[model samples]
Target: MRHWRRIAVTLLPLLFALLHVSGVLHLQVLERLESIIYDTRLRATMPGTMDTRITIVDIDERSLERIGQWPWGRDRMARFATELLDRQQVAVLGFDVVFAEPDGSSGLASLQRLAQGPLAASPGFSEQLARLTPELDYDARFAQALQGRPVVLGYYFTSDRDGQARGVLPTPALSRDRLRGKPLRATSWQGHGSNIEVLAKAAPAAGFFNSITDSDGVVRSLPLLAEYQGQYYESLALAMLRVATGYSDLSPLYDAFSEFDHDVLSGVILAKGQSRLLLPVDPNLATLIPYRGPGDVSGGSYRYISASDVLEGRLPEASLKGQLVLVGSTAPGLVDLRVTPVGRTYPGVEAHANLLSAFLDGANVLQPNFAPDFDVLQLVVTGLLLALSLPLLTAGRAVLLSAGVLAGLVGLNLWLYQVQGLVMPLATVLVMALSAFTLNMVYGYFVESRTKRELAALFGTYVPPELVEEMLKEPERYSMDAANQELTVMFCDMRGFTALSEHMEPLQLQAMLNGVFSRLTHIIRSRRQGTIDKYMGDCVMAFWGAPVATPGHAELAVAAALEMTQAVALLNEEHHRQGLPQIGVGIGLNTGTMCVGDMGSDIRRSYTVIGDAVNLGSRLEGLSKTYGVTMVVSDTTRALAPGFIWQELDRVRVKGKAQAVTIYTPVGTEAEPLAPERQQRLATWQQLLAAYRAQEWDACTLLLRNLHAAEPGNILYSLYAGRVEALRVLPFQPDWDGATQFDTK
Candidate 1:
């Protein structure tokens, strides 16, 4: 019963463990926690230095302020692109902006309308408009600047169901028919907001510049391939990489087990005349964005060149020569900012730059489909081991164990991330192990401690004060439920108590009784560390080996019985001095199996013992008067306390018991063995008992007389003498086993 509470306490962590392992409870909180950890690790491991191979032509605040707010004329943009390609000699160029509408700033359409309307017959107006057409047609001028240049235009995909599609879309990276009958669950869009037809035709290649944010609104990863109208399109980063690497063909890489399975889009294979590169992606064909560092203009991972400088040719040609350039804006008014793991407000263009950098470097983090399975395995193994081991250990050991497990989990996760470039889900595993450990520690301290204190209070009086403190250390190990256990029980009562109470006034009687019981309880508990079960008016019932187990319980009970008798004698002496009636107590001790615990009805309950052993102790206490002895113990107790000197009283069947038991009285400890004179008398008494049982009446009478004469005040010898006389007058039975039986209790 005692250990059951501890076992129950240990199982709490397992409950949470099972829920997490079985996926019954999705710990969304853990996911958030893991995100925080991921951000921290990402920042710590980032190469804060710059990457010089790629350059960003940022339309920064300075650029915007210097070159009249945004919508810079198409002619000016055309000149900017032409300058980077021809003058600066950049290897490749990509735009992170869209040109969905024609540049109507030149008012070319208005002039043409005027020529065709009211001025239809005006040759002079027609000639002037035709002459000014080349300068006024800004869209054609920008298109001509883009022709024959290695430029990739950027566009966006719309997921809104009701959004209207506009402009022209480039050829799909992978046509719908190529992916027929395959299970591709890539992000699909219903409509697109793309570049104008003239710009799209002039650009060598183009890709969507859409950034996908997670549920938490952080742009951690992006789909490399998205589906629109059953056709696949590449991201701006992938398209740029392809153009830079001279990859002409892009195809889906499926899992090896199933070729036509669209759902198993492992990655995309970029091929250029037999040279190929496999880009790993998640199930949705998304790749994690490997951020270099915070995208600062001065000392960040990528160099940022002001668009104004590039337009005005303020920078050296060597700076942009052979560099892969990405034209984007970082102005606040542009609203091209995002929340990223590295920075809260990050320029969306820098995200594509980082992705491009990762693709070229071949360092993109991969999250395979089996990562969640790994997470679950880690969570279950760590959680279950800790739950099972912690309960059996001390608080300090449990703490150490939990710390080691947590450290192992964190260390393994970081190792895989840093060394192998594997981005596993660390949040779920870490949170489960941490939560289980923390809950167990808290339960032990707050809940388990409270229960222990309560148990200590309940059993404080039942057991000795010293034992009570020991019980408090592990309260769960002890319980007050009735259970069978081998123990020692004792019953001590004051003789002639009824007559003494009748002679005294009620107050005097109460005072006397209280003093006697208090002194006797102190002897039983303080001397031998026994449990005081209860007080039956004139008798004190006590036991040992309950509430807390003690190996020498029988020995302690016998020692306490002797001390109680001595304590009563001292009390009698004080009573004689005060002219009060002297008191004598008789104690009985027995050792056997008994049921001990809190027992009673709802109205009241007590921590006590019950069984034949307890009954025998009470009956032995009653027989103390008949034998004229201070204390009597059954043979079981005498055997257990071999260190004590004893006198065998008789073999008798006690009241309400069918079996005969040998009873003895503990005279003193082995430290003071019996004297030779008392030893001689004991021998004579044994001989007299044997003769009486053998029906030698005359011989029994002679031996009893001599024993009584040797010790005239020995009432036990006189009682045996009288018993022999009574037996002589009755018919002796052949089956008599020399045992006495009492019918009354």
Candidate 2:
């Protein structure tokens, strides 16, 4: 029952996180973190190579400057399209722009106005105007250039202004009747900014170019299909892909499990002749932009040809021949740049180019439809591991264990992303695991505070502290009966005491040992609130989370251990001043389930813990000297603690213990970040360690040399370096698990 309290407290964080994942609760922070992580992973694994197949006819600053700014007369646009299609002989062309208004650059509207009013009665004026109207109509010329060619025009959809629409929208990819009243989670809008009627009729196909901006205001994806006026329209990129592939049909692919899916679509399929292409989309009918690299004309993802150059034909002959060109603007004044994962000022047209290339290459990264379930599963598993294990571990061991689990989680996520092209939710589970550990530790720290006050009032100086600790208080579960309980045990052994006793007089030695014991005992009891078991010659044994029932016994014990180390250091400093031999201390801590009670012979009974956990703690104390560290904590203890930086010592199978346990040496609290030089060295050492474990002897050896060069005096680095050398020459051992076996305690 007592253990259940701590367990429930530990499980609180996991429960809250589960709620968040289940959508019962919303955590904006988690969502933002997931986005940031997604961006990072996307950028890291993107193939930064250029794709020559798709080119951007960039209406860049240079083009805008040379051509006298954007919306450059429709006559020039006709020339631009003619130059690319007829002169350059490009394979396909798509516009990442719109023509919603009439082109009045030819002064034809003014001439017509005069013919309708003042010049109506003029002699032969209407006749002369009619003769020149064909050449003066610029919009007609532009439309003529696009007519019946393999060109797709771009437009945008808007949900604003009471659904007011402009111009003519392109043919719907999926008509309303095709849906048959089924539901879809596609992006929908009430209004649109489409190409003019003449241009829309002339272009064989057209699609929208509206970008999808995430909550963080980054353009990470664009809708491949969007809903408007009860019909679905394809994106410009999708239209281009279909044109290039010569696919003539588009259909929605519904998830077979429609009853559970509420008629939501799984993806869309395009088929023509014997060829077929499947494009997966999220609930929003959007697909992530698989950016090749950064986005501008200089981003190197795609070749960029200046619009002015394309218009004036100022290039090597047939340079753009056989290329698929997307016409768009990148001039800052044109406002086509977007904030993307690859760059802040990413040219919007390149986004379409990237998408088009992805469509062509069949390499699209998407969030798996089962991501919600996967997220919940990961959160539950990780939370359960931390909750069930942390209570029986010390603070240092808790931190180490949590860190290991976190690393595993991150590695697994990256694997699925790079290999499976799946975007699973990571931050919720990550935050839940971390939060559970933190709250677990915090619960232990604050619990049972009133126990001390009650004990003090009941028995002042008569009863032993241990006896009052387990009062069997009414309605509470604390007791003195022999029973198993999770606990943290400590062993602190004084070094150099034997030599000091030999040199000093018996009376002086007794006084020195007693004084040292007093200081150490004070640290354990008054400072860190621990229960001392007994004094064995020059060593002191203690335990936490016992009769008084401290929830954070491991952390309390570790803090006490750290304080004792500092006390010894101060003692050595005083010894130096007085010309006496300086003494040292080594502390070991372990946390596990143990039977603690008053158990001894009738003549001399005492309260103490008895179990393998206690034995392991003693063994760890002896290892402190081997590692040249003040404290050595078992993996369990290390995992129970949080917020402290730890340096991994080793994984060893101690004598009398078949199971190998990882060990760690505490450095300091996380409040003080490591120096840059130390951080670099630590990073190198970690890399070297990973290589050694993986049996990459060559890389391991090289890294070891670098580590040795940097930290020549580090004994641990030298030790591991020797191990790497020995393994380098050894024959392959399939059973090796990177753990060192020790025959001695």
User: Model 2: which ten-residue window has the lowest total lDDT?
Assistant: 471-480
Please estimate how well model 1 matches the true structure, expressed as its whole-model Cα lDDT: 0.83
Cα RMSD for predicted model 1? 15.9
lDDT by residue (41-97, candidate 1, tens digit) is: 888888877778899999999998889888788999988988999889998899999
TM-scores for every predicted model = 0.60, 0.61
Once superposed on the true structure, which residue ranges of model 2 sit more than 4 Å away at CA? 121-123, 256-262, 394-396, 442-745
Give candidate 1's error at residue 704 in angstroms. Answer: 73
lDDT of each: 0.83, 0.84
